[model samples]
Target: MSLSPAFLDELRARTSLSALIGKTTKLQKAGREFRGCCPFHNEKTPSFYVNDDKGFYHCFGCSAHGDAIRWMTDQRGLPFIDAVKELAQSAGLEMPATDPRAAKKAERQKGLHEAMEDAAAFFTEQLHGIAGADARAVLEKRGISAETARTFGFGFAPDARNRLRTALKSYGDAMLVEAGLLIQVEGKEPYDRFRGRLMIPIRDPRGRVIAFGGRIIGDGEPKYLNSPDTPLFDKGRTLYNLDRAAPASRKSARAIVVEGYMDVVALAQAGIGEAVAPLGTALTEAQLERLWRMVDVPIVCLDGDAAGQKAAMRAAHRALPMLAPGKSLAFVTLPDGQDPDDLVRSKGAAPMEKLLAETQPLVDRLWQAELAAEPLDTPEQRAGLKQRLADLIRPITDASVKYEYQAEFRRRFDAHFSPQRRPFVPFEKRTGGKRPAGRSGWQPALPVTEDAKKVHAAGIDRVLAKAVLAGLIRHPAEIARHMEVLGSLRLADGALGRLFEAVVDLAVEEQALDSTRLVTILARSGLGDVAGELLRADTMPYSFTQKSADPVRAQADLDEAIAILVARPEVDMMLADATSAMQSRFTDDAFERQVALVREKQALELRLANLVQANEDARALGPEEN
Candidate 1:
């Protein structure tokens, strides 16, 4: 639920920005403001200044300046709502519900939070109080120090029925069931799912316990067992140790992503504190994108075994296209047959530190890994490897970075696979005018049909509407140029339209829109794809260096694209059928037929004009065209 501007203003006034930020960074009295090194970026100079009177702070060095909320958002790398929630918690203030649905969702989240807190306390008690000696011994045997165990809130669940059920009696049986802390049995009773294990509480970025990760204390089928999906926890959506790592990320300006919870814990314990791990999943695009926001670079730490190597390679492949020139990755490989936990235990924190210090850049590691595989002796292998390298490099929009990678790929490909005399044969067939001289009409290697195009176009439109709304709302001047276009068009009627409406409404009410509020909206609207598309579209603001930057020019370009789409031969055929149907409805109106023809002619004329404008060498339109 969105707070009123007046309410937000009041909340901002109530909280002391200087005091809140002073707790983290050492601030000194300047003339009229407090000054300190920026917390959000690495800097030696005292560029970050906070003006208590203005309720704002600015970093002259980095230009990271904003209001109190923006300051917290920058510092924590959290969404605005998350930052507001953080600040509200600190102030012991409740968020006023602005809508009924939001109020209900908030109520559900509070229940889940309470359940998780209860489960954590119960598990913690079990570790120390009774029937947890065996689990403690297992930790000792694994070389986990008592201090380390306490630091991570390590615990165990007894191998018995209703342990957590009895512990969380206040929240109700439904709470425990929903929280995935207890599993119901048909005849007997509900039992704790994470019994006979060393517990690792999976906290959110706010440090609230959302789920648990358990390591087998005894001989068990699965080495690690995690809490099942609940209203609060989705393993894929979270990063282990994000609570601790996020602050470190903001300070250090980088984060290290590892393969396991142990890797994250061990690294943090080892003083490589800015480390997090994906919860029992591959390093996803979503996880990577989120990490990039928190840190300038995210080093991927993978295991040394075959599976680890594969995981690392997969991460590198996923990350390459997203890598900007300034952004980067490093690969950390633990010793053979060892994970980060084991390495830290056997070799101590110093060795782990040394490993991080000696980590290889992702590009170097990826190149070495690719080259380490079977020889480029065969033509097929050479072609396959070259294609694989190209697939990884082409999506990056940065020309300099792409060019560097392209040159590096070509050099490496030549060094590894190229025969001394024979030229490398292209993998994909060339098409269009570039095709072999004897070839007839250029056919798409993979032609998307009209049905596919319609579906894809709808998806693209959903993404476009969300993106355009976000852009236009942020830049008010854009509203006049784009609103009519947005209003005239029809998108796929569903959750996406609802979300677009919500954003537009928010913009209308607040005169500014917060992207975070849209998150819950998008999630509720069942528009995850649209949300993901919006999140993933890393659009750089257009600079008015070209004619395309003008609103008229840009819209004209868009209109042309739309006109061409409407005037497609397939579309023309479809329009003919539509017109015939309309004719039947009209009964006997020759004027209707003429009017339809005239509209079609106008559309064709627009398409022709666009073609001519876009391509100066295009043919001219005559009076007959009208």
Candidate 2:
């Protein structure tokens, strides 16, 4: 039975050399490698060492050197096949099927690997040769030193498609195509897949060249291109620079995920060496779990833009469903419109370091994403937020971890949505219809004026919109404070939206406009009754007390109310669309969509109810206690 080289490599990688050696002899950590007395012979000097990085244990005392499998066979007196089987079981690897052609397959793979290595060397030579002047100039412009270029094995693939095929005639086109160095199509000759671009050799975890990535040096569509999935490479499972970054991670206790391979190279060039990138795909579960094997919390340094933010959210959402105790991702959003490559190039290493150091937890990022995705002023919207949080948390399979997350979410919800206390405790709830003592321990009571502003005749959305408009009118100068948010808002009431826009336009034109002046301007716009109704004390959904109604606080609260007012209509339309879509017979895709929409509607309704409840929390106390 011929064992495949990949299967053998898998077995070796999964085996802990130190553990295999330690069972028979004592071991001590000596830097990256472990040291122990030679188990092969009697010696106290300790000339034995197991190098996990190298995947072999060696003894100077006796010429004993082998990997976990060899040690099992040599020292434990097990047959070769039995040893491999035992180790495979221990490492949780399935045994490859026995095949008579396995030896030929393995030989072919070795040839392909050698061919790729030779191709990498040729490309590197081309980078240094006179033919690579343009590539070298681009390198110089990027500040990649000769030494750095050599370290990253930066190279150039010439524009001539047949250059590689001609030079590598020894390997022939068949193996080249198999190795992905040449592209093969029906009725077409094999040609180079990469040409006229900067070349990057992608290696596997064991530092073997399995694939290649190319970046266009000039105007091009993709900007960056990677090898397609082949027998030798799976883009989704491989990180661009893991072979170096894995060892580097041992020193830094962190791994940085960036957008492109060049970002990794740039960070490595800048002395921040612990960086890796997914091969032309969004961060996946396999990629994340691989990182977790290296560090407790990997830093996901994303580009600071809308697209980057969306990517971060996708990663966060994927991670939420797989979270375990002491395992998660930290997010570092680069400055707006900048990637690691851009940032490191402009600001050098310090700013990148600062951003990496000040990382945000995955949970906080998740909350921010959902919270900002929609308005939460209405009870339905707020409830929607809570429900989204729950859906995200429900994926935590670990009971203790799930419970702790639940508690944290509960605490946040309470902080944002807890019922406000009445100015004075209600007589029946506090004293069972009995009069309570005064503050000075005396039985004195004074008639209290109810906050008549708490009641509203209009719908909750309309009430909140009126309160926001009233706040803006009452403190016209404060309109500047929320102009950006107000301008962006799409109020559920069309008339209100138009009125709000006019108010903003006036605010910009007349900065010093006061409440009376603003109302006079609106009266001329034929929105005088709307303005009048909004300004009435009875339209206020929540009691913004004389103190709380200061320009700054009112502006903030008014913004929150406006968010709710705008969100309700958006939710209604979405719900209606979703309901209409569900009228069709349910398929797998439709079922998922229906479930998601129903869940969203539930949360929205809950949020609207919560906002209403919060407003109602302000009570009408008949008498004040002194």
Per-residue lDDT over 1-626 for candidate 2, one digit per residue giving the tens place of the 0 to 100 score: 77888899889988998988888789999976899888788997989989886688989889799999999998898999999999999999988777768878988988988998899998999988888989999988988889988888889999888888888989989989888888999899999988988998999987888888888878886888788887789888899899999879889888999988878989999998989998878998889888988887999987899988888888887887678879989999888999998998999999999988899998788767777879888989988887777767766665456545654665578656755433433435666775544422322111111221121112235555666677777778877877777777655547787787788899999999988899899999998877776777654554331223323334444555566665655555554444445453323354354445555545655555544443342232111200
Error of 1 at 284 (Å): 1.1
448-511, model 1: which lDDT tens digit per residue? Answer: 3474356445533333344454444334344444455545555567766665665555455554
Cα RMSD of all models vs. native, in order, equals 21.4, 23.5
* Stretch of 10 with least lDDT, candidate 1: 617-626
